[model samples]
Target chain A: MTTESVRVAVAQTVPEFGAVDRNRRRTLEIVRKNADADLVVLPELATTGYVFESESELADLAEPRDGETASAWAEAAAETGTWIVGGVAERAGASYYNSALVVSPDGLEGVYRKVHPWNEEKRWFAAGSDLPVFETPFGRLGVQICNDQWFPEATITQARAGADLIAVPTNWVPNPDGDGRPGDWTAGVHQAVAHADANRVWIACADRAGTERGTAFEGQSVVVAPDGVPAAGPAPADGEHVLAVDCDLARARDKSLTPRDDALADRRPEVYDLG
Target chain B: MTTESVRVAVAQTVPEFGAVDRNRRRTLEIVRKNADADLVVLPELATTGYVFESESELADLAEPRDGETASAWAEAAAETGTWIVGGVAERAGASYYNSALVVSPDGLEGVYRKVHPWNEEKRWFAAGSDLPVFETPFGRLGVQICNDQWFPEATITQARAGADLIAVPTNWVPNPDGDGRPGDWTAGVHQAVAHADANRVWIACADRAGTERGTAFEGQSVVVAPDGVPAAGPAPADGEHVLAVDCDLARARDKSLTPRDDALADRRPEVYDLG
Candidate 1:
């Protein structure tokens, strides 16, 4: 199962609301600490945080597409010779986008905007049309942020597009209907595992920690194998945590779940209705 | 959450291979034992068993749509005032279909032919075209068999078709990559949870137990809540077990995962490339 071995790090850290400078420093410090890891992932909106008081406040704190946030991360990645993926609230021309910025030792390489905005984010951010897969130093990476993880189509599409791993930068809130059980009906963890197994792709979700504007975040940051089991930390429910796991990206290539079943090949898409 | 509360029974039992008469009797016994239950569900091909040695053997054991299997289950349901749903090897005209038979006190209410046949079954059965939703006394019921549950789109489409509960009669095989983690990777339990939570629908999978022809059946039968958590037994890895849970079918109606996020309403289907 070991092929193209890579060490991945998930930084589940808290971001101060509307504090761009502080959050940028926090993000840089977290990424620098994991310099030995081949790939480092940070939580959603790591540059500005979540839960805006107003659209104006979000705009005030948002960075430009090629802004200070990207430069800082690129510099850090270059210094560490690592590939970094993190979420940011980006100002794209006249509109704003909840984006996942990709940084490699070479430079800031790609940006993937959130396809499906969650809740009030729809009121602020423009939904992205082009979902790009990045051929990185570590592996082929697909980007998703927060609510986009809820859609199986997003993950399925990424897998078809040849992404070995889907990196989710998430600001997860506590599920109101949690039955004290962790998997389903609570958070997107099980969905991550489900999609990973079904699509034969590794899934690493870096979720935010602590309370922001009265909303508590679920910080069960996880790195799941293609086999649909956790290879790394489900972190802590609410805290700053660092988790690193050695992953063989090759295992994600074979969609064959068993001797008989090939995930995508076995799909009866012709009979399926996408409603 | 309580709108229409109904007691549903899942009988996780093994069917002797090539013994249709004995297996039919066994199914009747299980259903009669749970006579008090509002809805009773059994495993895939409960009357004929799984893993047929030959196409001729499968045809020999197959029952007509209105034959012994349906009549026995219908009689049991009528005598007990219960609605029964279970898998059967059906002889539809000259072609065979891996079907889920729905029996009420009235008689055979509906038959949902297994659309996506697993491996060898593809050689023996004709794939179904229409995936129908039944308006039952218990709730709006959607039926699927073993391998069909692997596809998220099938379940999501069922939810969209106005089914409160998706009843899956499955003969689950042990996952090739299972490290005994007991969730998504192992059984479809977490995938069931994931899809159910994403669509706000209750899912009940009644999987078989015991080994047949060197293939081990995973007997983790479960009834999951609309919130994507199990409400009943994953029975055991291998055993004869009966699980019953009183579920509020209405919670499945409110797709509101949070005050802000409505599962179906939030879907960006336009951007989804199911290809």
Candidate 2:
């Protein structure tokens, strides 16, 4: 494995419901601005905001894997010689899935569907059947969207599959009491830190900001190091911002939390019995 | 299914290496001091201490599940009408296992061996082959030791098995770069919060303090509510302390994060592909 550092960026943006063009443009702008970074991540459903009024409304906003948003993101990635992971509302024939696309300079790298739909999403999107990790020049990458973060298995599966970095495209909503405690971090941010620490992989969470319909998205996007500490921005909780940090991909490959213990290698799945 | 609250106490104490008597007495003192609490959690290997120099040293300190430590803690639990979960280095037949015992007013309720032994532990202890959750007066209780907290499957399995509360008997060591970030809390604490939030289960972690054989234990014992916020002291980072909080076990039963979403029911195990 190569011991090289890769620049990673997490862009927190706000999108208007049903305003596909504006949302796509906003994400494109963030990518262009953070061109120096090797990878840039955008929030869940960036091109089509969450809080769909109906299945028809969601269907109207959804696109295929090779649709407009993917083409635009691919073009931008090619222009900047960077990789982008962004969320989209995907239409696969009659079913719609909340998905994220991994676009490198070459083109579309992979597509990851939301494995577990959250709340109202159950009504509009079909749950994904698989978790796939993609290969990149810097390292193996895994992409999971939004509510998928709630499942530890999502991160664990990816990390176990040799993913060095997991980019999360999330539209974080507030917790019942509040987003998080002792600081500005949302519960989602803490989850990212825990996932990074537990799996020995870098986790970059790009969360959306501002209110869409009646739902107010939390904007505290964060980039967590393999050591579980926040290496960059949890940005402001309710504003658009960009956070970039240099991550050593090799640290993820060496799952050793210490000389004798490895994070992934140490798992006792025989005892897990995950029923 | 009870909606009533359960008073939980996490006692953080310092144990001298090989001073089993003193450590046991200290634990008894803490239990006696917090007699009002319905449940009390103590650190991993609370009586024997960690950092063994050799296999013989570990063997010398190891005890049967019903040995001195368990008997004493059981007596204390009977006297206080409380339930106690504490770690012990177990001598089972010819093998040694890192394990935790659940003692209640009735007697020894259950035992949980650490599934994932960390670092030097692998050299001395036989890995546990199963994960078990005990039926408690307050709720279904799950117990896991130290490094077991690093594995999400530990918590997920117990939660899925109907555990309302998971008591962690941990001797938290400092991470490669300090224990935790953003505050005095350790990475272990972050893991507790994430587990509680993701599984919708109450998590009470009792950790140890002071240094032993060049190894220092982090003393930030924390009790996280089902909402993923610390309800009581992370105690102090380096001192003996007791953290008590009233946890509504019913909230753990109701895994719903939102009206439309239930944390436990939302899991997609089919896609996990843990291997």
lDDT of each: 0.84, 0.89
Off by over 4 Å in 1: A1-3, A180-186, B1-3, B180-185
Writing each residue's lDDT as its tens digit, candidate 1 over B1-275 gives: 12489888888988888888998898899889988888889999998889987889987999888998889999999999888899899998899999989999899998999977888887788889877899887679999887787778788778878899988999988767666353433547777778887888988889889998888898989898987777986678778898999989988888886577788877777777776
Taking all chains together, each candidate's TM-score versus the true structure is: 0.94, 0.96
TM (B chain), model 2 = 0.97
Docking quality band of candidate 1, CAPRI definitions: medium
lDDT of 2 by residue, A21-137 (tens): 999999998899989999999999998889998988987889999999999999999999889999999999999999999999999988999998888898898988989999888
Candidate 2 colliding pairs, count: 0
- Model 2 ranges off by over 4 Å: A1-3, B1-3
What are the interface RMSDs of all the models? 2.4, 1.9
Model 2, B1-275: lDDT tens digits are 13468999999989888999999999999999999999999999999998888999988899999998889998999999999999889999999999998999888887898889988898899988888989887889988888888899999999989999999999998886844476767889999998998998999999999999899888989999888988886788798999988899988999877788888888887888786
How close to the true structure is residue B270 of candidate 2, measured as C-alpha lDDT?
Answer: 82
DockQ of 1: 0.55
Candidate 1, residues A7-104: lDDT per residue as tens digits?
A: 88989989888888998899899888888888889999988888887789887988886799899999999999888899999997779989989989
Q: Candidate 1: what lDDT?
A: 0.84
Q: Judge candidate 1 at residue B70 and give its lDDT.
A: 89
